[model samples]
Target chain A: MKQYDVVVIGAGPAGLAAACEAYQNGAGKILVVERDKEPGGILNQCIHNGFGLHYFKEELTGPEYAGRFIEMLNNTNAELMLDTMVLAVTEDRKISMINPRDGYFTVQAGAVVLAMGCRERTRGAIGIPGTRPAGVFTAGAAQRYVNIEGYMVGKKVVILGSGDIGLIMARRMTLEGAKVAACVELMPYSNGLNRNIVQCLNDYGIPLYLSHTITEIRGKRRVEGVVVSRVDGGGKPVPGTERFFDCDTVLLSVGLIPENELSRSAGIALDPRTKGPVVYENMETSIPGIFASGNVVHVHDLVDFVTAESQRAGAAAADFCRRKEQPGGEPAVAIESGENVGCTVPQHIRPDRIDQYAEVFFRVGRVFSNSEIEVASGGRVLSVFKREHMAPGEMERIVIPKKFLENASGGAVTVSAKEAKEN
Target chain B: MTHLICIICPKGCHLNVDEQNGYAVTGNGCPRGAEYGKKELTNPTRVLTSTVKIKGGLHRRCPVKTDRAIPKGLMFDAMKLLNGVELSAPVRRGDVVLADLLGTGANLVVTKSM
Candidate 1:
């Protein structure tokens, strides 16, 4: 049995950042465990730009974003175990990791940070009524194929969802000398950032079919074509609106689910909304010593945000190892989504602290323009923010002021959205 | 008449400008729209990203990013400078592609290693 002061699982952006934080914050030793041959995780193949807009102020590709933190990790006393998979994490921070080179090893740590990112929602998850053909690939898989393996996924394609991956792939496929017939979006609005739509589709002249869905995939050995139809207000396929496109491949970018089987097995409570661990203000889970960040906590669209969140988790884990408890006083309020709001991250908040601001990340349930968002507890509006428009696709984030968090007496926070009155 | 714009949301409004008055907004969809529009029209800016050329590599493009936000008006000039850049291979990620982008006081950094 080996031991370290902190064991950071999955050496992705979050994992790497957390490890660096723990090391910088006086953790005696830190071990980063990654399943891949490389430690970059999804960022390794995310060759597109749009990352680091917040933290770095410049647009970076995924690998670039991950690399910045990995560089920081190299300067620290953090040890990395690549090609090693963590088999399980016990309640007391015992981690079982395995790789062909190292076999199996159990390490006990004073603290653990779960940075195991997320997995792409596949065709099976969506239950898209289709024949399992050779050309059906998750957007991420297709990304790996094209970006890493240096292979063209298809000559003509129809993407299933407008998630960032699919949108980027549409542009990538086009750049690779392939024809992207169209990108069909199931919802009334795109599930991607406006900039993506503008750069990936609008600039390239790829038609985006909103409120439409792929009804069936017509393929045998490989993809031949697809049957698409428009959806009604209730999202039911309109019978008379079936359209077919001759295509070679279908890409699914439905959504992302946090990779949290280990968190679940260790009896950590999961947030039903996020399908990830229910974390407190410090990114600490219900289990005291276990902390989570990045996609494992909630799917973050930007790598910059992921890095920031991981740093918080790492710093908190280090504080935990030093026996420094976050002074607990006031009960936190549950943040609820109201109206066009989807859900918020850091589901709970601490009301007593002077620095009580909680970074609330959310998505609009639908698209709206000229919107007023209000944060309130017990019928008193705590804070109100205005936006020109909000979309279901792009993730929106705001800071809940320390004053509001400290003043709320009850253990609940509600965020509501209303259409701005036209003047 | 403060031209309130809502770039925060997708609604990019062109409000009638009257900074002389006490922040009165027109042509906005919501209250937030008015506030954002006022801020943006008064002090308009945005985040910028563009790629620098890489030399002696199979990968033609190694993405570069700003270390922080810059004025939106400087974007075209930034792109002009970035478009003329060419760096050699063996460039690791986070390497400084352009140390300081034309005195914007912001560094243009490589995000991926080619």
Candidate 2:
């Protein structure tokens, strides 16, 4: 059995950044295991730009962003294991893994970081009423086929769900000489970034149908066409509002759920809202000495946020390895999502573990203009952050100053978004 | 007035460009938005990204992008140029595949090394 101070899973953006940060933070004998043949993970197929604007302060493509981190990891002494899959992770920090060369092996890790990332929701997950068709694919699958495999997925397409991936693929398929008929979304508002909507859909003269969904997919062996219908406020299809589209492919980009089977096997407490592990301010999971970050913790819109979050997990894992014991800290103050807020990361925070402030990341339940985020404790307002615009598609962050946390009288803090008052 | 969303960054500031007033822009959070609003209505451009054929490499396709934004009207022509391109392995990032694409003053360069 091999032994390591820290073991990071999935050599994607999260794993790559975490391993490098761990190495730099005085963690010795660190190991990064990846199931893919290459090191960049999903970024290898995401060849689009608009990444690394916040982290590197320069605009870079997905592969370029991952390449920079891979280069950084190559300069470190941390070992990387490619073409390897982790089977199970025991609560004791024992990782069971398999590879062609290594066969089946186990490694003892002082601390573990879960960064397996997330997977795209498939047609089966959404239960789309359609014949088993060959031309239907998830937006991400089409992306891999076109960008990496050099294969065009379709000629005439009707895309369901206007997430970022679907919007991007709409342009990509068009650039490849394919005709994208329409991008349909169930929600009244798009789930993707505003920039994507303008650049990918509006730029190409493609129509976007909001509050609409595919009622039926008409095809036998291959995708032939689809029937789209408007949905009411309750998301039920409105009768006599169906429109048919003649197409060859239907791309689904509904949502992404974090891959956390290994974490569940380790008996880690999972958060229903995030479908990831419940974590502390330091990214430590319910199990001591085990941490998680990146999309494995929650699906992030931007890769830059993943890098920042994973670096914190990496640094914390390194500290855990060095201490070799869980340090006693003050009681954790739980975080609650209030009105208009969907969810909050780092479900709780310990005063002693935090530095000057604790950063809380969240998303709104709906869109609002001239809004203010209020952080309250014990029925008293601690702080308020103003925003010109707030939307469910964009993630928001607020920092709780240490002084405010010290002044909190309640055992938990509530964060909410409300319309700003007119002066 | 022409309305446009600034794609300069993720902020996506909505700008109203007054074409009659020398293309002055409002509702912009930054100078980039103002410039973008002005240019978008006059001569729109975009940074095109796509993949091309590759041989003797780890993957069959190599991702590439234009070094700068090209005229939006020339996007399809720029993509057509890649259809005839096929590169061998050992290609490095930032290596130019085509220079001054369609006279747009932007070079097509490889984004990922293969």
Candidate 3:
């Protein structure tokens, strides 16, 4: 049984950043395992730009962003294993993996970072009522086919669910000489970023139909068309509002789910909202020495945020390896979502383990204008942050200073959003 | 007045451009948004990203992007240029495939090494 100071799973932006940060923080004998033949993971297939705005401070394509991190990891002494798949991860930090070169092996790690990332929600996951057809694919699958495999998925298309990927593909398909008829969304508002909506849809003259869904896919062996219908406020399809689109393909981009089979098998507690492992401020899971970060914790819109988060997990994992003990023995301050807030990361905070402030990331329940986000403890407001516009599509963050929690009475803090009062 | 969303950043500030008043912009979060509003009304430009055919590489397609934004109307013509390009393996990132793309003074550069 081989032993390592730290073992990071997946070679995406998250794992690459975590391994590099851990190495920089003095962790020794680090190993990064990836199932793919190459590094960079999904970013390799994401050929578009609009990444690395926050971290690299330059607008770069997905491959370029991941390339920078790959360069950094190559500069470190950490080992990288490509074309390897992890079989199981035990609660005691034992990792079982297999590869063509290694066959089968187990390794013991002083600390493990779960950065398996996330997967796209497919047609089966959404359960769209349609005929089993050959012309249907997840937006990501089509993206991989067109960008990486050098194949065109369709010539005429109708995209369901206005997520960022769907919006991006609308423009991508158009640029590739494909006619994008429409982009349909069940929700009243798009789940993608506003910039994507404008640059991808409006720029290409593709029609976007909000509060609509594909009720039926009309095709036998290959897709010939689709029937889209308007949905009511309850998200149910309304009668007499069905519209048909003549197309050869349909792309679904509903949502993303954090891949957490290994975490669940390890008996790590999972959050219902995030469908990922629950973690503290330092990204440590319930099991000591088991840290999780990036999309394995929650779906993030930006790779830059994922890089920042994985760096924190990496630094903490290195510290754990050095201390060789459990985290601080202080009662963790529970963080809860309140009115108009969907969910929050770092479900709790250990005051003694934190520095000056703890950054709480969350999303709003709906679109809000002139809104105020308030953090409260013991029925008293601790901090208030104002925003000109807030939307469910965009993740929000607020930092809580240590001074506010020093004398706090309750052991929990609530984060809520409300309309700002007019002066 | 024309209402437009500033696609310069993720913030997506809503800007109202008064074309009648020399494209005076309002409701922008930064100077870039104001500049974007003016340029968008005058001559919109976009940095196009796409994949071109590659030979003897890890992948069949290599990703590329324009070094600088080009005129938006020339996107299709620029893509047409990519259709005729087939690069060999061992291409490095930042290597220019085409210089002064479509006379827009922007070079088509590889975004990933193949």
Among these predictions, the greatest lDDT belongs to 3
Lowest lDDT 10-residue stretch of candidate 3 chain A: A324-333
Per residue, candidate 1 scores C-alpha lDDT tens digits across A23-55 of 888998899988887778898777666667668
- Per-candidate RMSD, Å: 6.6, 1.0, 0.9
Candidate 3 positional error at A146, Å: 0.4
Interface RMSD of each: 6.0, 0.7, 0.7
Candidate 3: tens digits of C-alpha lDDT, residues A192-222:
9999999999999999999999999988999
The DockQ scores of all candidates, in the order shown, are 0.13, 0.87, 0.88
* Ten contiguous residues minimizing lDDT sum, candidate 1 chain B: B3-12
Tens digits of per-residue lDDT, candidate 2, A199-227, equal 99999999999999999999898999999
Candidate 3 accuracy as TM-score: 0.99
DockQ category of candidate 2? high
Fraction of the native A-B contacts that model 3 recovers: 0.82
Give residue A49's error in model 3 in angstroms.
0.9
Give candidate 1 regions above 4 Å deviation.
Answer: A324-330, A352-356, A421-423, B1-111
lDDT of 2 at A291: 96
